[model samples]
Target: MNKKVWLIYGMLALATSTWGSAFIAGKYAVLSFEPATVAFLRFFGAAILLFPIMWIMVKNHTKPTLKDYGLFAILGLTGIAIYNICFFLASKHAPVIKSSLFIASNPVLIVLLSGLFLKEKITKNNIIGMIIALTGVAFIITNGHLLTLFQLGFEPIDWILLGAVVSWALYSVVGKIVLKKYTSVESTTYAVAFGTLFLLPFALFETTWQDVQLATWDAWVAIAHMSVFVTVVSFIMYYQGIKEVGAAKASIFINVMPVSAVIMATVFLGESFTFAHGIGAVCVLTGVYVGTNTKKWTLFKRQNKLRVQTKDSA
Candidate 1:
């Protein structure tokens, strides 16, 4: 693959890995900080860090118009402030497996929404790839029993999860267009800044320095990891991916998240890798291959095979 494709792959992989491991990191951070507080600190840290970098990147660039700022404010509210609050609250009440499975359908929602809002094509290969990828995601998360679909129930909290995914789908599809007006750096920074602003009131209500003061080393490490890698770096990569690939194709990479999380848990948390992991990984990769515009290698091989067959016939 070309450098551009490789860069996209690398960025997507890193972002997903950081996000996958965030469950562990968040688990640690929340031991001290409230979920709301953790959420706030993440955006606040990202926004603060981005200011200097944003200046360096945009100093000689066109200034974002007031209208652009307005759109960014909405972006923050939807993607960062609102989406996270809903996710945390829903996670408290929703069944873990069901939530994972449903959230894994995030790409599917993005594919459909991109078609509607972004006018991106939903191709046959993309559809087939999404199905295969999601099937693998469900298989791994459910440990391949497959009967959990019949057993799952949708409580009211589940709707919140659905809302969270929809909010993010809008964020991804909308942000793709927004990037045309702003640098990836500028877009990410402004959105995060606004999101942090909106989150301040709620976070301040629950946030106390006592938890931070009392936090263990592990908790602090997790806080930094989430703030830097999960929120900041991951958001940068995500926006870049959306800009490089269309939203639907970019979203497909998220299927790797469950696999990443499980692998991280196994290595760091001393969990076991099972047959389901192996199978699910294969399926996930296969799905990604199909979903993406990565046909050059396959086409090359097919052409070579055809040439050899013709020579043999002669």
Candidate 2:
């Protein structure tokens, strides 16, 4: 409505677009480095920058208790280490667009997990949307051969991408607990620090100092982009959008991610968009919209209208 609001919207869009591009950058990074190494490098770089930023942004920071350390470790493991490892591994095997689509479906899983674990309410729309979104994911993964999933089972890369999605959902669910105690920036910074530590041994096992030194500039650039833009800057901007617009309104910008990923993959990676992708994208996006906007749906509107009319008649 106003200039500031428009600017916030722009930042939100740009943040999501950068997230889409992270898949592309990850695809490039995994071409040269092992998945563990690539993940380690990206987060290690992000951790370096995030600590100082967190320090500056969050004043009156108290010392972390032992429980806080444990929580941070869990966040690091689920959201950072495991998720990124699976992501880079999947990037090595799957198309970036496909990977992005899988990640885009994360909200469905988050909603389900929240209902189960957080004692949150699950509406009929949530169930219907989950079914539709999963159907789309099946189509995308099977290349529209959904029927064969029973006979053929999932591809290994599909499992890996699913792992990433589940890990991210868990990260978000756990983050709800952590955020109640700490600011998002503070929690994220500590989590990234611990995640970097967790990744170190695996990175060392997979690659030596010589190997790290020999990594191509393209790989370095990709890791840098993922660390600086995708992880840190995008998170900040998205959080800002949430602060200004409310989470539900800000979340609508996330739909732009998979679409942007498709476009970026086409333009930068020269990847082809398939018929299955088109169909799957439609289903997933529509399902996500419905899943998130339960109160805004026609049935709910009609129900509200009837209630209002009944009240007026009385």
Candidate 3:
């Protein structure tokens, strides 16, 4: 509502849009590069871009212990390495909009997982949110006929994309451990470094000079967009968004990512938006709203206020 809030919201939109566009970019890049190469180059370039920032942030900080290094390695393996590889594969095989939608479900999955592993409360609203989201997921994967899931008509690629979502959610959930010791940026730097290291062997054996030479200028441009905007600049803005707005408010901004991805993919990649997609998208977005905005909604606040007054009187 205020100037600063407007600025932060704008930045959050920029960050989400950049990330969403990365899916479109990846679709272009993979035409010339192997999926592994795409994954490797992304974080390798991201590491190069982020190093100076990381250095500036951590230069005077205390050195990490061996245990810390171990945690960083694990985060790198799960979040950066595995997640990147799976994501690239998903992009290669699945529709961009579908992949983005699956990604949009991350918050819901994180909520479900948090309840199980982190001993976090799974509120009634959260359960309602998960059901709404999963129903949307079912609709999309089944092409608007939820029974299609029973028929096994969905593409293997769709399943692969969904698996990538799980991998990413696990990355977020588990990173809490490393986050305890380091700032998000610092943890990200170490994770990217280690992840790139893990990707190197596959990149070396799988990606050749011929592949690089065969890549088009447009493909390289796509990679640069992802490496610079999506990986580095977007993350910096996201962190700032978190600082400006609380994490809860900032977290809701991520719902924009899928919408942006769908728009970019439709415009650039010539993807079609169908009635089924519209219905499913609405469901998914509504589910996110219900889940993330539980405390922010007017009705929820009014109910809380009344409950407090009742308690006091009693």
TM-score sort, best first:
2, 3, 1
Indicate whether candidate 2 or candidate 3 has the larger lDDT.
2
Report the C-alpha lDDT of model 3 over 1-314, residue by residue, as the tens digit. Answer: 78989999999988988889989988888888888788888888999988899888666665889988887888788788888887888788888888888778778878778778888777877778878887887777776888768777668787677677787777787777677777888888888999999999999998888888888998898888888999999999999899888788888889889999999889988988778888889889888788756666648768899999999999
For each predicted model, how many residue pairs clash, with residues at least 3 apart or on different chains?
0, 0, 0
Which candidate leads in TM-score? 2
Worst 10 residues of 2 by lDDT: 292-301
Rank by lDDT, descending? Answer: 2, 3, 1
Q: List the lowest-lDDT window of 10 residues for candidate 3.
A: 292-301
Q: What's the lDDT for all of these models?
A: 0.72, 0.90, 0.84
Output the TM-score of candidate 2: 0.94
| TM-scores of the models, in the order given | 0.74, 0.94, 0.92
Question: Mind giving the per-residue lDDT tens digits that candidate 1 earns over 234-257?
Answer: 877886788888766676677767
TM-score of 3: 0.92
Query: Which ranges of candidate 2 are over 4 A from the true structure?
Result: 298-314
After superposition on all C-alphas, the RMSD of every candidate to the true structure, in Å, is 4.9, 2.8, 3.3
The runs of at least 3 residues in candidate 1 whose Cα sits more than 4 Å from the true structure, single-residue gaps closed, are 1-16, 86-108, 154-164, 233-259, 272-274, 294-314
